[model samples]
Structures are given as structure tokens and as C-alpha cells.
Target: MNQLNYEEISTEFKNYFLNNYRNFIDEQIKEVKNSKFLINVSDYTSETIDEPHRIVTNFLKEKNIKNHRITNLYKTFEFEFDFYLLMLTFDERRKMDIELYEEIWRHNQKL
Candidate 1:
């Protein structure tokens, strides 16, 4: 993708994630303390495939996220991971913040 296109796509993806997560947080009766989610990309032949689940799984493994839900476009052969982080309490939200750094690290790898 061109630089501009890449930036647009990246921003869209980031916003989608953050918005969904915030909505999840808003749904809770208690405050959120920690939460995390992941988005993975993989290529079989120099072309990135849309495997959001894989991204989520890898993110979960890399960051040690335990209480989150994932939504993904499915493929038959690979594993899928949660796309949303919904922690109903402050403690869980705190854990999420700790794990969120993994998202930054993972995104940085693409740069």
C-alpha cells in the first residue's frame, strides 16, 4: 500500500479497536482498571492476510492478556483470538493497560 493508504488503514483499524473497547468499558457497571486486545497480521507470500484472530492470539501470548473477548474474520486452518477487552472492574482495566503496550510494540514492528 502507498504511505497515505497505509496510514489511513492503520488509523481506521486503530480507531475501530479503541472505539469498540471503549464501548465495552462503558457497558460495565463498575469502572475498568485493566484490559487488552490484539490485532495480528501474517503473510504467506509477501502479502498480508486478514487474520485478526491470529493477531489477537499472538498479542494475548505476547502480552499475557487473560480476560478479553475477540471478534475475527474466520479462516478454517488457523486459530482466532478475541478482539475486545471488557473488564468490568478497576483491577482488570489496570491489567489491560499493562498489556496494551504489547499493541504498541506489535504495531511498531510493522514500521
Candidate 2:
């Protein structure tokens, strides 16, 4: 039997989440200036928000953004929906962060 490393297992899980998930970001949410990528998801169905949160949370932790906050917005608007928000900061411009972003991209490529 082949033993899978933690990174491999993690990559697998992240891939699964991205592959089988769909989300819509509200343009009304202001962009973060000089900050890293922000990923937000909303629960408009019976699906749980924990899966995406776990993947995003780990990525944030790896980038040393332990204090990065995740917010849940559940509001009634003639509809029921729950939103999850994550704010991150990069050391440089989004272009410069491409290299690091690629890392996330590559990991996500498995999806």
C-alpha cells in the first residue's frame, strides 16, 4: 500500500472542494487595498459552508494570516442565504503575488 503524505491528502481535499463547488461573489464588496486575496462563499442551498471554509482557512494559515477573519452573513432578503467572507493581505501587488498565487493554483489544478 502507498502511504499518502499530509500535503498530498490536503491537496486532494482542496481539489475536491474546488471541483464540486460553485459560488458567486458580490461586486458590491469593496476590494482590499494592498491586501491579499479574499475568498467569499454563500450558502444558498442545503450545502454546508464548512468545506470551503476549511480549505480557505488552511491556505490562510500557511500564509501566516492566523488572525485573518471569516465572517458569516445570514440575512433575510425575501430569501434565505448565508455568506462566508475571508480577507487576506499580500506582501506585494497582485501581479507580484502571482508566484505565490501559482502555488495555490497548482494545488487547485488537481481539481
Instruction: Give the number of the best model, judged by lDDT.
Output: 1
Per-prediction tally of clashes: 13, 3
* Candidate 2 C-alpha error for residue 3, in Å: 6.4
What lDDT is obtained when candidate 1 is compared to the true structure?
A: 0.37
lDDT of each: 0.37, 0.34
What TM-score does prediction 2 earn?
0.22
lDDT of 2 at 49: 30
Q: How far is candidate 2 from the true structure (C-alpha RMSD, Å)?
A: 17.6
User: Which clashing pairs does model 2 show?
Assistant: 36-88, 36-89, 36-90
RMSD of each: 18.1, 17.6
**Per-residue lDDT for 28-85 in model 1, tens only?**
3122122243233222111112233344344446544453333335743332224332
